[model samples]
Target: MVTPENVSSYIQQGLECEYIDVDGDGRHFEAVIVSKAFEGKGMLQQHQLVYRALGDRMEQIHALSMKTFTPEQWANQA
Candidate 1:
């Protein structure tokens, strides 16, 4: 029973993010994270960082879909 608030709070602690949107139906979530911390990290590392932030809650959370991007990547999309 991982709430959106729980995920939001956890992620905000590790990353200097511009935006974080989390949508969850209690057990599953879709997270869109935009942060400068993703700058030189690969997709696996980015996801790992997020997983670390969540701790054991990942097992409790059934599903997590993420769209992560660095600030520069985000800026390029605009």
Candidate 2:
């Protein structure tokens, strides 16, 4: 019953994101998240922040793969 939109909202609610996109098929999800909070964080720390945001809702997500980036980092990708 967990839709991608729900997942996206959860992340947005917890983190101050510049941009976020999530896609999934109920049980598994993938997200690309951009935020100023990610500026100096390492990959593991970035993921931890997202996990903290998800909180208890993480239990409902069977799998989650994400690409986290700082606002400047994201802009460089284009």
On residues 1-78, what C-alpha lDDT tens digit does candidate 2 reach at each position? 999999999999999999999999999999999999998999999999999999999999999999999999999999
Alpha-carbon shift of residue 44 in model 1 (angstroms) = 0.8
Q: CA lDDT, every prediction?
A: 0.85, 0.97
Tell me the tens digit of each residue's lDDT in model 1 across 1-78: 679988888878866679899999988899999887788999999988888877876778888899999988878887
Per-residue lDDT of 32 in model 1? 90
| Candidate 2 segments exceeding 4 Å error | none
| Per-residue error (Å), model 1, residue 40 | 1.0
